[model samples]
Target: MDYYKVNSKNLSLLKERVSVPTYDRTNVKAGILHIGIGGFHRAHEAFYTDELLNKNSNSNWGICGVALLSFDQRIYQTLKDQNGLYTLIVKELDGTLTKTIIGSIVDYLFAPENPIAVIERIANPEIKIITLTITEGGYNYNEATGEFEIENPSIQKDLKNPNDPKTVFGYLTQGLKLRKENNVSGCTIQSCDNIQGNGHVTKKMLLSYVKHAEPELVSWIESHVSFPNSMVDRITPATVSADMAALKETSGIEDAWPVVCEPFKQWVIEDDFIAGRPAWEKVGAQFVEDVVPYEKMKLSLLNAGHSVLGILGTLIGYSTIDEVVNDTVVSAFLEAYMEQEVIPTLGDLEGVDLNEYKKSLLQRFGNIYIKDQVDRICSESSAKIPKFMLPTVQSQLKDGGSIELAAFVIASWAIYSLGVDENGTKIPIKDAVKAVLHEKAVAAKSNPKAFLDIESIFGSLADSESFVEVFTKSYQNIMQFGVKKCLIDLNSKF
Candidate 1:
């Protein structure tokens, strides 16, 4: 059971079954500085970059990862200890596994350790492209208003002291200012986050923050900086102890922080980089002129499909996505939801076949080896539902299409927020607005319409009598009959 710990010193000790980086990690220069080094980043972006390094002679696209929040301390320490090297375990559908040591990330900076060092690295002329994988909430923008939250306490603190900045906005502003002072050419700011129009949103939020800090820098940023929208997809679950154990047993590499994900990976980016970028397209990435259609497709189907399964599966006592999809009724329901409700919302997509995409989605979700947890998908329903699911609901309502499935999904979420399942097992509610959902969900036990009144979440859909009727009916069905009976009856309808 003795295994070499995953680090620079242990690379030579790795088993032949495991694939180590063929390129020289020591000579790699940090051309891409990535913020928010989460599991998704390690699995998706870093995986692509690793392949690029191995295939081509270009060593300039090495990633220098930054961990901004205090919460990232553990990951930072793990990466630092491993010399920015970690195992990527890809779980195949037939339970086969492929373990590779991802060496794209050569350097790491924990911002909390030294803010100035982080800023200086960003200001480095050699770091041609700065990428971000910060989650949707990390942007610090008002979603409803589409404006930066300037009154935020963190924003206030960052504005007052730009030198010792606390927020991404502050750090970026200071770094860009330093670059300008040093006469360095502007770099590309690419966002690998899941947000729709991520590049445009980043540019807007960053410029808004910078305008308040320094008005003179706005015009310069407009001309120099490039923000490329990207659509990134990978089912990378949180790395648990089991993943580490699996890596140790399968490859004899004792990695402290290994990433586990499904075999499928995708990235569709807008072809716009100011300074330069890696030839990622050589490694299964697509460069398009516009990423909006792809964004809309993925968010509507794949992302919303996760929400559908996550909410319903939790109530039905299913722990993982495969378990949810394996059930005949549940899988049928998902297929019907995509075919009747979701596909209609998306118009003609270039170079995409809707049927094939949906088929692929079903196969991906049912990959038993992945073990994508329902709880991971269920977390942050308050933020996720609005972005991924509700738009479909609104579209269905406008076009007078069937809204029963969408209503059922929302009702399931409302029931889930009640903190207990049908069998009286406590369901842990994980959301930023947990208290609000709990309060509203409790109030809805008596008045079913009360939960819909949160305009921030539901918007004008609450005012529609047809939606209220269907939603209330679905709510009553689940409360009176039970999850399985209600699901069967609902499935029969489609």
Candidate 2:
């Protein structure tokens, strides 16, 4: 077995498997049209589809990936290079690693290069479910108001011609309009982003676009489309030269595009597709009537847990989640934050064991092999904080419980927004509020109210006495004593 020939090796492995899965490549048809072709999608959704295809020979769940942004051309070329084949390396905490080739993505289309072709494919009746992982920011909606930003150039163009626009909502609207015109059965639009009530968020953005662009079409879409909420989890890290080298060494396959993720993966989706869906349950996916509790549990706890480590981890100069989890101080902070702050705030969801979930989350975080980056998790904190952390903070405040850790997290954001870590190293702050955050931080150096004025980031919560006191106090503490001293103080106080 000449492993240097990685593609051949993969093909041979695929052939040797007893259940040589085969799809009606001709009649299979595109049942899933996915937006934002990224590493997470490859590790998560594409993996699920591969499993389904393996179980059922006649399954028609082939995916046609549409990359909306121009920079994604590199990814497009990489996937195309390998005939849409790639390996998902799932690294376990206990030094165990497993790799599998995902083959669900049947084709790729760059929207900018061929918008009409992409639109026509989505318009096709064959695409039963239009799934998205376009990131929370991709929707281009104002988080505080939950309304589409009409001022956005993309939104403006999308409004002018719903049939042809650059944005995802525009593409979806245009596709749906074509579907309605062609009398094609309406498809389910599933959002796989980490936003709370993500499906609703996506629906709102799409509907908002339709409202201004085509009012009658909005009604038709409202009646037809099913945007099922989903809670997706996986600690996938960005691929770098190290990852590529590791893949080449292990498999003797020089994969230009390989995805590295933790062994733990989860997909809890609402079973609400119109033209039917795969028995994903067979492939370790959970299909439930209400994904709310599951989503809340995952988002507020697991996802939020990751964010907690993300900010603190970066401040501590740790590169990965595993490093953060292994640090005694970081680990203690997370455990206390989860048990005392996060869990107490969460209302009981039927059939969910909060204790068990928290334990599992800790275990997952401790997985060293995952090598999940703090920076990656910390990206888009402005959007992520509201979904993952603020809800818990809000609930805890309402219940009269102390929110010391939550306050610390918020303060950490304020500190991070200053664009430098404790060591005076430049901390690359990645958020929509990046530009204005520095100015706010400077002004707030004299008065905390200046920081609170960023309504988009803080929402109405910043005005509240409870949040204001804690956030301001913590920010002051960080300024006076620094991150480590503040952490020590928080450990003592809370």
**lDDT per prediction?**
0.90, 0.80
lDDT of 2 at 95: 77
Residue 462 local lDDT, model 1: 78
**Model 2: clashing residue pairs?**
none
Best by lDDT: 1
Candidate 2: where are CA atoms >4 Å away? 1-10, 13-28, 161-164
Could you say which candidate leads in TM-score?
Answer: 1
Taking the tens digit of each residue's C-alpha lDDT, what string does model 1 give over 1-494? Answer: 56799898888777355899999999999999999999999999999999999996589999999999889999999999999999999998889888899999999999988999999999999999999988877888754567788999999999999888888999999899888888889999999887889999999999999999977889889988999999999999888888888777866788899999999989999999999889999999999999999998999899999999888899989889999999988889889999999999999999999999999999999998888889999987887887888888889999999899889889988899999887888998888779989999999999889999877677677789999999999999999998788889988888
Clashing pairs in 1: none
TM for every model, in the order presented, reads 0.97, 0.95
lDDT tens digits by residue: candidate 2, 1-494: 33443242356554442122354333445689999989999999988888788766446788888888889999888887777777777786677657676778888888989888888888898888989998878878876787789799878876776555788877887788888999998889999998878888888888887888777898888888998889999878898788778766766666788888887789998888877776788889988888888888888888888988888878767788889888877777777888888777667778778888788888888887777778888888878887888888888888898788888887777777777777777887888768888888778788766777788867888768877888888888878887777776667755
Give Cα distance to truth, residue 309, candidate 1, Å. 0.7
In order, what is each prediction's RMSD in angstroms? Answer: 1.5, 2.2
